[model samples]
Target chain A: MSDKSTLFKFDNISVTVEGKQVVNSVSLNIKRGEVHAIMGPNGSGKSSLSNALMGHPAYNITNGQAALDGVDILGMAADERSRAGLFLAFQYPLAIPGVTVANFMRTALQAHRGKDADMADFRKLFKKKMADLSIDPTFATRYLNDGFSGGEKKRIEILQLSVLDPKMAILDETDSGLDIDALKEVSKGINEYRNNNNAVLMVTHYQRLLNYVKPDFVHVMMDGRLVTSGGPELALKLEDQGYEWVEKEFGQKAEA
Target chain B: MNIVTDSKYMIPHQSPALERGPAWLREKRRASQTEFNELPLPRRGLHLWRYTDPSGFMAIPDSADETAPSENYKLVEKLELDHLKSGNLEALVTDFGGRDIKVSRSGDDVTKGLVISSLSEAANSHAELIEKHLYSLIGGSSGKFEAMNSALWNDGIFIYVPDNVEVKKPLHLLREAGVEGSIQYPRLLVVVGKNASLTIVDEYGGGSSDFRNGQSYSNAVVEIIAEQDSRLRYISLQRQASGMQSYLTHRAQAQAGASILTIPLVFGAAISKQNFGVLLDGKGADSKMYGLLFGTSRQHLDNHTLHHHRAGMTTSDIDFKVVLRDKAMSAYTGLIRIEEDAKTCEAYQENRNLLLSDSTRAQTVPELEILNEDVSCSHGATAGPIDPMQIFQLQSRGIHEADAVRMIVSGYVQSSLKLVPEDLRERISEFVAHRLEDI
Candidate 1:
């Protein structure tokens, strides 16, 4: 099969965080130009799946094989994985105090484009991206995520998503803590970053974000496993019905 | 009982610099010489001497005299000269191991009543101001090393801004020590008059390159006075060469309605012990100190800061940050003391240390002494390795591990670096970056 058919795929991925398995042998494939949404209740391992895939130090992938463009990524370091065309938008983006957003982005871009990246070009691109996200120009100089509101932090995450421009982006709970207006702006950033050559896998608890950025596939996670998979309508059903029915049908009890 | 009777560390009775000054000045030097001879090396049990060994800074008996400035010192001298010619600085003073002192003014018509001359020259020209304020804050009785500097300094820098005169640009002092096995005493005395304002950058560089072959010793003393309603900003940048043992004592007093800002940036030297203190002597006086130190390799750095509120309604704040990597070690002790009569005063002190490697060691002690009932005082200290989560967040963005560490460290010092002047800030940033390059 052509690599384009499976831009990002993980098979039998089992993750144990701190010696307790959080994601159990979950398997999925996402093709280029597709957006896959993982909808689940809290503690259902949706975030863990994305974190393990991104090579978080605390998350141990016991038995899994992840690949981007047909290259194994399980053995790579977090930074190497990122350089190999994978990205993770953290649910709670850590605040790097005293580091300006412009400075952080410029350094990240340099890492991706090698040290020869023109700084003048970076400034221009950063200004345009900040404008595109409706972020105030002043934020370019503001410390990265420091003292930012919840919605502002989420917006900055998506800003990184667009600026880094990876082939496969795994966004963990990018829609949480954001008001409707902020949710709309974040979704707009995700949509803008999505194209025929890139794919997105968003782990979200709510179906509201999917309304703005339509997904080609939606998966239901229960007890650290993908219990069911379907099209966009599945997310709407899950939103309307909640995860109680999925738990009952899959015979997997949610942790108390 | 541990009196250091070594004559090598004692000042000679007929030192040329002491002979050139007035009789009163010569008497003060003689007294300092006696103090140095009688004072003992600080005991290891003492709080200030617990981490650093005082013997390392002792004068080497057969050390060489003044040598030509290193190539790096020459480069920095040219840079400061350029800054002077371009009007970025009010004046530039270069002192080579306290032997030769040169002063260059900006040439532009700047503020009036501004005096910049060698300390010996000022002892004769501006004797009234120099004699009255010099040694008032730091003197023979301050400490053993302080007394050594007081008696042995061959030449020093003296700056004075008269009442209501404001120097628009910074005055830069480039104090360079000698090469291997050399012992030099560098002194500075600054007085800012009532309602006047001045900024000074005192930078130290050039010294021995290895201790096994031979080591150099530098003992420096700085005393500052900010009169009523005046403003003073002093930045002390120490980037000496390896294999140098350096000791520095700096003290300043701010009068009523005056404010003093002190920034100490330390990066080089094999072993360094620096003490900085500010006394709020009058009511409504204010003082703020921001210090940053970055140590690498096997360097040892020990620093102390004091904010003393002696008058009612005075205020003070201190933020000292230290970053250590490799096998380097740093010990920071800060104290905020409010006197009994200093009622309704407010003081805050914080010392944060970032250890970049498991092998690096850091010690932080933040102390407060509030003798009044109607005051607010708080002190905090924290020493730990960088947050792995922050590093992971940066690394997940594709930055190499070393570059990520560098970026995080640069950010940690960004706040203090913001307080420095533009050119110096860039130079300090370069120093910090160089320290973290191999991380």
Candidate 2:
């Protein structure tokens, strides 16, 4: 899930939820300067894979390894996973009352980088990032995710991505609840970040974000497994023709 | 806890310092000393000291440690006075060991006729003002220690602002203790005239942070009087020493159309028992009392507050918060009294505590006695550990657990911090934040 070097490799990583195999024997290797997207229907284990990679307690890895470069990361805690260059943009970020966004980001940036942010420097960067995401600067002092709209929360998650600049980021349904303007803005931030040779694992149920970020590799997961893998055209085809066609080919009915 | 009053611990009032004071004060001192010897010490029978243990006062130092004076008084000298040349501060009083060091800033229009002088000097020069307010809160016979302070107190400060005069800047009273084992009674008497507004900050600190090792007990009594249509902000900053066990009482009376704010920041003392009492007597009078305490190590702190609403249409709000760690313990007991005539009054009280470690603990009790049927009053209290999810959220961002705890504690206390005036809020916030870093 994370390591010193910027390489994300998941090999036969099987995950189970309450004794049921949600992510069965998933294997993928993502390196710097690459964009990978996973598009799957509900119950296809798209979110489970992301959560397992980030070491969520609900997801148990029965076998295989998720390594960053040569270092194994399955043993690390969720926080340690974050420190080791693995960032998971949650579909629903936790609302932390009484803690401001600026304070949270300051501490996060200090941890990611080895020094505290100077007041002027932090304000400048915060203002710039907020501007780039079309977020009101006043959001800096608001409680972290408390009472934030869906679009606002998604933008804040992307805001964090732009600021922390993690070596590898997993965008889990970031584009689900956003309007067109917000989707374009979030995708723009992602595109600018991938230009720095950083990697991203985009897990989505729609082909909407791929139209903006344009993943280099597309994956169609079904029955807790990737039934098909292709280039950018795969996402367009899935958008035109729903998962019913894929289920017929894979011999498994979709969950909904 | 119970202990019989020991005759051998009686203080003799015939010292040279007593001789320097006026003869009437000397006679009063001797009489109070005798009262101290006869009054029974607080036991379970006394309700005020119920939660407090009397055994802590059983053994007393053989004699009071004699103090010369404070020579290092540069804190006021280095003040950025240029920014506040014309605001308020009717008088400036600086005393070390009850001796008047120097008084200045009284020649301007705002300071004319303002009375600021040493307690001993006022006992003779301003006899009427001193005698009127002296022991007004303690009632001259509350307890053995209070009676002893009334009789043995060497020097203190007296502040009086005349009618219609508003001191814009805050008056400063600095009480610095140098000796390790000295017994000192620091007293302050304030009377704000009608239609006058004033802010007084009384800061008590050690002469040196590297205080010598020894046991000392200090009892500080403060009384304030606010006349009609006046405003007062009183702050007590007690940062004495780790070896000191202290009792501080801040009692005030608010007249009609008066507004008063009292905030006490306690960051020092091994064991401290503090009392804040306010009496709202006039219609339309308002009072806000907030206390913030941060305890580390084995410090023991007990805080009690009293709000007496004697008139209708009065309003009062109270909040007290404490953060404890490392076996430190604190208890907060508050009382709000609303009599029959106090109809239509509004009263609110809240106490919150955060325990940073398993060994530390806090107890909060909010008691109300309301005799009026048409009044609004409520109270709430909470004491618990920080949320683990909050900690994990901060930690996931790479913050150390210790820093995360500090942040949570700081945020928990900040709810009460926002209720105070703007002047001391930032300074006290920084002090609390700094204390949390190493706790």
Candidate 3:
């Protein structure tokens, strides 16, 4: 805590979606230059926590005090929070049928940076970023995530993360539905984007992604609550023994 | 609302405008004059006139007086002339209120059997060709407005592409209207000969800006014939001012083995009603129509499209899209018909409307008539607001809500815009952007 200050902090954040409490008073603090993973089973409220943090319309944050870099973001709009250095890589990215990737990126960048924020060279910068992610240059002209393969969609999300370069990045199941090679490529982009001035919080189901991008802390989310907290070894233990042990040892089992 | 009771716009038998053409052309005009006086005004609750009132398009006493051009028409003229000089366009024609037609041709291709001239001039030089094809597709019997234009049209445009001639660049026709209380009748006749190809951008710009106090009127008719094995791309761009009431009818016929592409990019006028139809007359002919319209403010827009398969083994497809915001209203009706003898024909039609605001209204009616069992026909109609999920996705990426909505609306019409030329595509995109500014 002395070496690295808190970049993102949420205190007792509860989310209610469609008249049902999904995330129950979840409290977490992510420090700069660190990576944290929240491992959980299918209906454990991991994605709900991430979505509520990003201000998804359907997921209402009933009670919470969320801040980014000591600035209150609970009352800010999604775009305001994004401009305030917060990024969320959606697990299922929506397809904008006729919007090209380059156009979308430029618009988003203009909103974050000033409208007159002159990139030294926009085309060259975009080309280099696409090359870094091993994505084809043709994808720049193609519609954003429209008709893209699963791997391609995930890679584009990381591409956004790298381009936006936010202070706190919450990747909601970024590793889901990705093959080993795609997962590696995505991990490479995420790792490249990580530095001492930023933080990463990954919501994931399996521990396979932890092997690629090592996390400093691991927490188990169950029944809309953070039941246990531990080190990276806890992820391996959860992978080996599954969430059954954590349910019996920590609290009651989650409803199916 | 009865046009027969409107005496100011009634055409006299000895009107000077109708007497300029040749003897045969004069006879046709005289017949159309009689038809115009006899035909009644379109009634409300009719098939295509349900949502729009016909009285807006009728000419008043002031509409007969000559007036000056809108201020923007000069700038637009210079821009088009620049396109001609830069080789972006094959030819440029400026028709001022359909009373004056000026033609400017460029490149060696135009000199070789590519005829672009005023209709009056062509009627004398190419009498047989003019008499045979003129008004054959759209004439007095088409509608009340058609008869009015046929009888009252002044000097107009006539384009003829000879056999085996291929014009690489687009031919631009700048139809400029006058200011408040001004009326114009614009006519266009294009014939593509056997195995030839041509592309035309018929752009309509200018009109009054005072809708309630001093409204202008414009009635237009277009007839196109794509001969055997020929190719034709006709792009109609309507971007007039807000205080204009415009009516237009466009029809084309595609011959055997020929293909026709019709694009109607409509984005202007206080009350605009346009009808576009194509007839597949010969076997194996194909026709496709892609249209886009964006309405803002309290504008009223009505559009209709038709694809008739008259011969066997023909194919046709129509995709018309509408985007409305504010208190704007739009009604789109598309019909696809396959004749009993037109076996193995394939026809498809789709009309989608996006309502950007809660007060905006949109109505889509897609009709299909298949008389033969061997044909394949399908029609779809959809009217809804923009998807909130799409907006959220854009907002999460740091795009503000308004910018996100603009981007989505622009993207919605991008597909149809792609089918046009680069210059027209850019112009249409700018129009779309301008309409979304106040939203």
Q: In model 3, which regions exceed 4 Å deviation?
A: A249-256, B1-14, B60-63, B107-111
Clashing pairs in 1: none
Q: Model 1 segments beyond 4 Å from truth?
A: A1-4, A117-120, A254-256, B1-20, B60-64
Q: Which stretches of candidate 2 lie over 4 Å from their true place?
A: A1-6, A11-64, A74-80, A90-100, A116-121, A141-154, A171-196, A201-256, B1-35, B44-51, B55-62, B68-92, B98-113, B207-213, B415-430, B433-439
Clashing residue pair totals per candidate (backbone < 3 A)? 0, 5, 0
**What DockQ do the predictions score, one after another?**
0.84, 0.34, 0.81
C-alpha lDDT (0 to 100) for residue B391 of candidate 1: 88
Q: Candidate 1 chain B, which ten residues in sequence have the lowest lDDT sum?
A: B1-10
The DockQ-based order of candidates, best leading, equals 1, 3, 2
**lDDT agreement of model 2 with the native:** 0.77
Q: How close is candidate 3 to the true structure, as a TM-score?
A: 0.96
Return the TM-scores of chain A for each candidate in numbered order: 0.96, 0.92, 0.97
| B164-266: candidate 1 lDDT, tens digit per residue | 9989899999999888767788999999999999999999999887766667778899999999999999999999998788899999999999999999999
Per residue, candidate 3 scores C-alpha lDDT tens digits across A119-236 of 6677888888999999999999999998999889999999999888899999989999999999999999999999988999999999999999999999999989999999999999
The better candidate by TM-score, 2 or 3, is 3
